[model samples]
Target: MKLTEVQEILAKSSQEDWIVDDESGSFTYKNDLNLHIDRADFDSYREFNEPWATSHPDPHAVSVEYVVKYGSSFVDKHTLVSVDGHRATLPMPKSINDLRVTESDVNFAKIVNIGDRVDEYLKRARLVEVEDNE
Candidate 1:
């Protein structure tokens, strides 16, 4: 698969939908998978305090948002629901690089393996097992 296709699939597909073909060495997105990462174990995430502040594309933008906007070309939409139903302002691609998509340009599905990466981080940090939500 080409770089663009990998990106497109990732933009719309969830972690559960990643499809890897063994023979052809191609990846695709499908909804049949019954696996997923329930939550991420991270030090912190970035968020914007001043939406109007023009200091280089809102430096306070949520760390994830900053990374997606500047780091990769994921233009699709994703949402999060609040437990308290509070209103907030957040957008994709807060910067040029994010935790998931690190490199400026690469085959997303091929390069990103959230589960393994997260596990490694948690293990190295001596964090306990994060129950897989599968």
Candidate 2:
């Protein structure tokens, strides 16, 4: 999605909700406070699930929670983890929706307690943008 479109969506959505309009995929949040991306897409609504859960029928992987820490220009401050098990702190993605590595300043790291379970969250916990240089 273009920046104009994302701005439009954000403008239309409520403050309690953050519409993650991007090129890769889109998901909306009730607010930035909670880490869980509630499955409330109007057409369908359900509980948030882990990206790897397959016992029932949901495309979500694991319930990953993230903590965004603010730091200086060259440091990362995002920590991601499962609501239940496993944890991985990732560097922010440079752009939202689209998973493109466009900047050399924003670095991303992946640490997993489990195999590929943490990968899901790490992928989703992308680098939104680089803070403007003041």
TM-score of each: 0.25, 0.21
Best TM-score among the predictions, by candidate number = 1
- The list of candidate 2 runs beyond 4 A from truth reads 1-58, 61-63, 66-76, 79-92, 101-109, 116-134
Give the Cα lDDT of each candidate: 0.29, 0.31
| All models, RMSD in angstroms | 15.5, 14.4
Kindly list the per-residue Cα lDDT of model 1 for residues 1-134, writing each as its tens digit: 34464445544454446555433323344542322111122234434333221233224333221122212333332322111111222222223332122222212322233332433332222323221221
* lDDT of candidate model 1 versus the reference: 0.29
